[model samples]
Target: MYEIELLINGRPFRGAAEARTTLADFLRHTLRLTGTHLGCEHGVCGACTVLVDGVSARSCLMLAVQADGAIVETVEGLAEHDGTLHPLQQAFRDAHGLQCGFCTPGMLMTLVELLRETPHPSEDEVRDAISGNICRCTGYQSIVDATLAVAGAAGTEGSEP
Candidate 1:
């Protein structure tokens, strides 16, 4: 067992993280923050996407110890402190970005990162941002709309095509 210290959504987490535990397993199984799902288990799927110091990355591809001392944010951590939905999450609801909800968590988390870089992403950019993520249920049109709506809500237009 390895002791790993990480800040998750501003909460300090320090404990015995099994040496073999992936960050995804640590967040979901150990921490009980199950919003980060294990889809492909490979880095390609992006289903385990989470923010490590404000950037999106595949949690399953990393060891729990690798996240030590890192600031990690999961889908559960995406809400405002006052409990209001983040604008992107609101846009997703307004635009029906989710169908099965399996990919929603990762998509939402990835959107946070994507929007930070491109507040108003064009439809194509939105698609490209989440290209690593796979959604078997929704066809992605609504997700694109949702992301675009967030960009519009933010009063910033991303790269225009």
Candidate 2:
């Protein structure tokens, strides 16, 4: 087993995993951070998306050892410690962007990276940013609308969690 250390969601985490273990598996099984769901483990489904050093990454495609010493952000970190929702999350809820919710975490993390890079993205940009993330429900219009809503409201200033 290889020991890996990561700064996750602002907290430090350490765990041991086989060298072949995917980061998603390490996060879910070893770290007990089930928010990083696994679907289409081949990395096609974005359900396992997370932020590694502020960039969106497919956790299933990355090994735990590969992510060692990296800063990771999962869906569980999007909300405030006081139970307040992040603007994007709140917008998603208000706009009904989620249905089955399987893709919400990936969608959120992807948009988080987009907003951080482009604070006010156009509708096309929002759509492009989430193109890789597939949502079986909601038809994606709601998700685009929700991201636009957050961009409009906060200009995404200080939106980083």
Candidate 3:
């Protein structure tokens, strides 16, 4: 077993895992952070997406040891400590972007990266940013709308014309 340490969701975490263990398994099984889901396990479905060192990554495709000393962000980190939703999360709820919710975490993390880089992304950019994530339930329009809503709110906040 290899000992791994990561800064997860703004907190430090340490655990031991086999060298071959995927980061998804380490997060879910060892660290008990179940918000990162596993689907397909081949890095195609994107359900196991997470932010590593501030970039979106497929957790299932990353080994636990490979992520040692990296900073990681999961869906659980999106909300405020006092239970307040992040703007993107609130927008998703308002826009009804999620149905079954299996893919919401990945989508949220992916968009989090996108919004950080492009605070006010166009509809096409939002769609392109999330193109890697596959959501079987919402058909994607709602998701796109939700991202745009968040971007729109950001664009309008504290702006004077």
The lDDT per prediction is 0.85, 0.92, 0.93
- How would you encode candidate 3's per-residue C-alpha lDDT over 1-161 as one tens digit per residue? 99999999999999999999999999999999999999989989889999999999999999999999999999999899999999989999999999999999999999999988888888889889888899999999999999888888888894310
Judging by lDDT against the true structure, name the best candidate: 3
lDDT of 2 by residue, 76-161 (tens): 99999999999899999999999999999999999999988988899999999999898999999999999888898775365542
The digit string of per-residue lDDT tens for model 1 on 1-161 reads 99888999889987778788999999988888898988989887788999998899999999999999999989888788898987778878888888788998889888888877776678888899889889987798999988887788667543421
Worst 10 residues of 3 by lDDT: 152-161
Model 2 error, position 158 (Å): 9.4
Error of 2 at 80 (Å): 0.6
TM-score winner between 1 and 3, please give it. 3
> What total of clashing residue pairs does each candidate reach?
1, 0, 0
Q: What TM-score against the true fold does each predicted structure earn?
A: 0.92, 0.95, 0.96
Q: Any idea what lDDT model 2 has? A: 0.92
- Order the candidate numbers by TM-score, best to worst: 3, 2, 1
Of the candidates shown, which would achieve the greatest TM-score relative to the real structure?
3
Clashes by residue pair, model 3: none
